[model samples]
Target: MNYRKLALTLAVLALPGVANAHVGLHTDGAMAGVSHPFSGLDHILAMVAVGFWASTLGGRARWIVPAAFVSVMALGGLMGIYGVPLPMVETGIALTVAVLGLLVAFEVKVPTAAAAVIVGICALFHGHAHGSELPEMAHAGGYVAGFMAATIVLHLIGIGLASLRFGKAGLIVGRLAGAAVALAGAVLIAG
Candidate 1:
């Protein structure tokens, strides 16, 4: 993969004001969706950690876990769009970041199926948040697609970082990143 290009793309996408300036709640649904994940530190950390954890697992998990998250998250989004009430949505999202970060930091090894299930649960909360916040005028299909694309990119970033092949040192670096994510989650919960 072209790391430079990927990094550049992510940098561009992560620009803070672009989405807000162009895609308001009543504006372009696609841009709004794309911008949503990057707008919140909580969403970014959890999505990236999901990728990092999947890579740490190192196998079929490299793909299955992320896929499961995306699929299940979309389902959760539908629930939100349809006005299904999920209590503690914010708490669930915060907990997801904390738990996923801890999983990455500790290098917890679990079966691929188990990992998928865990990530799937996290995705539900995230998707619900997305759904609930969607603008009334935004096209649902376009919005979902935009967010899903952004999400996949974040996951890919995590996978790329973990695949750096620095051996033991790389593992340490990954753990540190995970720790940072966990710390951010804690701050989110506390604040």
Candidate 2:
């Protein structure tokens, strides 16, 4: 879907988002909302995997799982914005990457209620990382809104990617992404 254009657009759009620079966007784009998912490899991979697996499952889960993650992640962002302290923010983010990656790779199936809780918890960690990393000039609310919006878009992109007719090739690539994410998580934990 015009990935080259998208990448170029993001580079231009991401310049002012200096705060997101910690994860490697040149500027602090505290206001990009759901699109924030692509700013960092860790966030992008895990969030995409979430969407991919959700799509794979189909049914109510197709939407319910990602919805749960976004809802709880909003709450977590609120907590962080309001100055609530969460220990090991980085570690939590790393663990989420690893866990979700594995979940996608293995096609782990859990009851809906349990699945919701798992997604919610992971979302909190993700949101908090976004909130805490905001640049100094950006308002907390605006910044959080921006990253949140960016995040949702990333999920949608993942869904789109999964919908492709790559057959076994697609599955193989998905598994590789998961393995890479898990490996990154391990390194994050070790650090």
Candidate 3:
């Protein structure tokens, strides 16, 4: 991978105005929703961490964990849309990154169902955040689809990274990435 090109691409995608540029503002709902996840470093990191942790589990968890996250996330989105209040959503999201990154860094092993539950709880906060940001004028269905697609894509990217082979180097790199994510979460909390 061309590190420079990747960095530039991510930088461009994460511009401040991107997340607030909702479909109700100017663009179509789906596109707006799709871009929203990439706009926030917090969302992006936590999502990718989900995939990293899943891949680390190395079994049926590879699929079940992400599936559970997506499924429960939808329910959380509905709760947000319906005006259900979840306290400390931002705190929850940041803590999710820290916890998930620790799981990846340490190669923690837990039952698949337990892992699913952990990720599912985190996904609820994420989904609710997305839903709360939804524009009234936007097509709700399209917006939901867009964010969900973007989220899955991010997860896949993390999974792909975890699947690569650099011999023993891969483990080191993975742990380093996890540490970076955790540090980012700490910064988010502090800032």
**TM-score top scorer:** 1
lDDT of 2: 0.72
- Candidate 2's displacement at residue 53, Å, is 1.8
Error of 3 at 132 (Å): 0.1
Better of 2 and 3 by lDDT: 3
Task: Write the residue-wise lDDT of candidate 3 on 1-191 in tens digits.
Answer: 56346535644543433556343473446666677788899989988888888988978898789778878877777787778999999998888888888888887899999999999999999989988888777677777777777777787777778888477898999998999888888887776
**After superposition, candidate 1 runs with Cα above 4 Å error:** 1-28
TM-score of each: 0.86, 0.77, 0.84
Model 1's alpha-carbon lDDT is 0.85
CA lDDT, candidate 1, residue 103: 95
Predicted model with the maximum lDDT: 1
Taken over the whole model, the C-alpha lDDT of each candidate is 0.85, 0.72, 0.80
Give RMSD to native, each candidate: 3.8, 5.6, 6.2
Candidate 3 lDDT at 110 equals: 97
What is the C-alpha lDDT profile of model 1 across 1-191, one tens digit per residue? 76468657765654433546543453557777777888898999999999889998988898889889989988888888889999999989998998999999999999999999999999999999998888788888777877787888889888887888498888788888889888888887886
Error of 2 at 71 (Å): 1.0
Instruction: List the lowest-lDDT window of 10 residues for candidate 3.
Output: 14-23
Cα error of candidate 1 at position 133, Å: 0.5
TM-score of 3: 0.84
Candidate 2 minimal-lDDT segment of 10 residues? 25-34
